[model samples]
Target: MASFEVIGGRKLSGEITPQGAKNEALQVICAVLLTEEPVTITNIPDIVDVQKLIQLLSEMGVTVTREDEETYTFEARNINLEYLESKQFVNLGRAIRGSVMIMGPMLARFGMCKLPKPGGDKIGRRRMDTHFIGLEKLGAKFKYDSSDEFFHINANGRLKGTYMLLDEASVTGTANIVMGAVMAEGLTTIYNAACEPYVQQLCRMLNRMGAKISGIGSNLLTIEGVEKLGGTTHKLLPDMIEIGSFIGMAAMTGSEITIKNCQIQELGLIPDTFRQLGIKMEFRGDDIYIPTQENYTIETYIDGSILTIADQIWPGFTPDLLSIALVVATQAKGTVLIHQKMFESRLFFVDKLIDMGAQIILCDPHRATVIGHNKQVSLRGIRMTSPDIRAGVALLIAALSADGKSVIDNVEQIDRGYQKIDQRLNALGAQITRI
Candidate 1:
């Protein structure tokens, strides 16, 4: 029920370290359940989702020892599979979509797993059909009880891998199958798998734990089933989404800020895509330094035409960040069309942006056209509530550049990913307070 009160138009300037990637951390923590020995994860962000996952694991009898604020050592050696059927475990399953991942590990080790319907951003229909289909290919039978609303998966004896061509490149679906395939017999060939950074990180971590996986960053993955996995320490990668958020914030507020320890190589096309908005940034070794600029303009095509920014799958722009990019475009000096192709409900938040005096036309459920300030108008502040994770951050960026006070409610949605967001923005002189 907490909210953020921000006195807007403050120049955010200073050094701000990005938290560990939330998506990657979620997958990595779930990967720990695949091993019986102690697995230590460093640079774990203190966020709501991570905390919820930790509580779920603890209720299942996994010993999670926090060595420090940013590190946790977890051992699932003594986890009771019976807890997977508990009402408390089913209740916590609604806390995050990643809770579905525990299904694979529990079934792999204990031959049975039960999970309630997972919960996450209400961006669109994130079907679990891919997950169930992939697991079915690996010899797991699923039964759904509509009255109780739980999925019961049972695998008698050892799981035998078969050829699985996922209907779509579902991120969590690919992760769940990958964990399940690690313990199956024979080879598991996964075609059209999700190759996002978080998926690749899970494959890498499983490899470190003795799972044989090939094609680490591609749509086709081959996993030779292994009998057992051991423990290993793995550092979570720098959050590229957080990096994109920082870039959007710096550009909108016209602040000079340095983001340290960014995994620049893994950023793929994110930096170049942001540069298209005329936001100047420099790479200083592992750090990304954003400098102050006046009158930033949107880049036009070669024939002097307006351009459009869109999102796609891996090796392309991420759909998760299209909301942030759209907010940044409002402060630029030209017009750009943003196409959010993946989620149908994502662009609906533009009405809030339009109320703050932004010139935006919601062309459809998945697209919007933004006409920048052209250095003539600035958005005035208004009271609003955050709707989702990426959209919430987009509103925060808008609030920072607006003229007066803006109060944003439902801040717990923001805390699910970004760690200590107010403190980090405060370091950059943003007048943001949590109440």
Candidate 2:
């Protein structure tokens, strides 16, 4: 288990560019399996989860060439479908939730695929029903092996297009269904689809590769099944989660930092959500410049009530950043409620922050009330363990702004999502040592 040894109370400055979106990279990289042609992708984040997915694909016999650190060309001309039955495949597939995505493309093209119960952050119960159900609507059959916890999915000939109103607008579920529907025989309409930038990028990339998809940025997507898809080059957007984390770090530590090339428009409600926490930021071109602030006050609702920031679908506050908001609010001037609707266990990390002297009330499994100290009191760092990726970075931010040293164990959780996080923050003057 890797750990981060951080000395807090040091203000950092300088510019840091966000990595290519991890969420987007996972989706599009799996889309390569839908075609035999070479799919070149740039801006892939060099991280553990992404690497695990790429290695999984390679073991499945997808020819992967690394053009650069962030660019890869994947040719799925001769995928080894037999590998799916191997115990080795199960070990690799169980390491990342993104491994579930390969099912759609593999089944769409090769007509069969198997997956072990996928693994990711233990935030809460992440259901795979949405993925399986949506694909079932497109004429796929699924069977579960209770003994091995593997899903066996097979398409009945070529998938026939149909309409599906998703139970939820799950990003991965929607991406999976879209990939499965792209090569079906007729028109497929997906209502209540995820319209996040990552999903939109996947749809656009499919279009570029000869698939016909409409509704590039809306919940209602229509896909006219093409006979086949071809090769295309795609670039991933900057990770909004990382960008939000950087914003929180800047405010918490009273530092001035510029986040460059942030693809500001695609960030949706992220900026305003942070603004609601009283963190001030300026948009200089495509860069976000956060100035040093000794104090920033949380905003009240329109009726002068305490502010409540809840996570919702796209165009709403992202559930992923609620931890960052909670951490940033620790030093803000007013009170706020963070409702983490998507994951029940995400707020459990607050007990660690409370140990460091932040006043936070864990209302329940999904909500917390934070009483900001307004920087009148600095958090005293202590030893802690990272429970998940977002919570890990949130703890790191808290440690950075604390008065003393802190040790964060299981930092591999953070590295799964954030690429070279300690090194990147260190370049901007943070004292984070990997031990």
Compare the candidates by lDDT and give the number of the best one. Answer: 2
Candidate 1 structure quality by residue, lDDT tens digits, 145-247: 9998999999887788889899989888899999999989999999999999889988998999999999999999999999999999988888899999999
Clashes per model (N, Cα, C within 3 A): 0, 0
TM-score winner: 2
Cα lDDT for residue 212, model 1?
Answer: 98
Model 2 bad stretches (over 4 Å)? none
Q: Which ten residues in a row have the lowest lDDT in candidate 2?
A: 103-112
Candidate 1 similarity to native, TM-score: 0.98
CA lDDT scores, all candidates in order:
0.90, 0.95
TM-score of model 2 vs. true structure: 0.99
Per-residue error at 275 for model 2, in Å?
Answer: 0.9
What is candidate 2's local distance difference test score?
Answer: 0.95
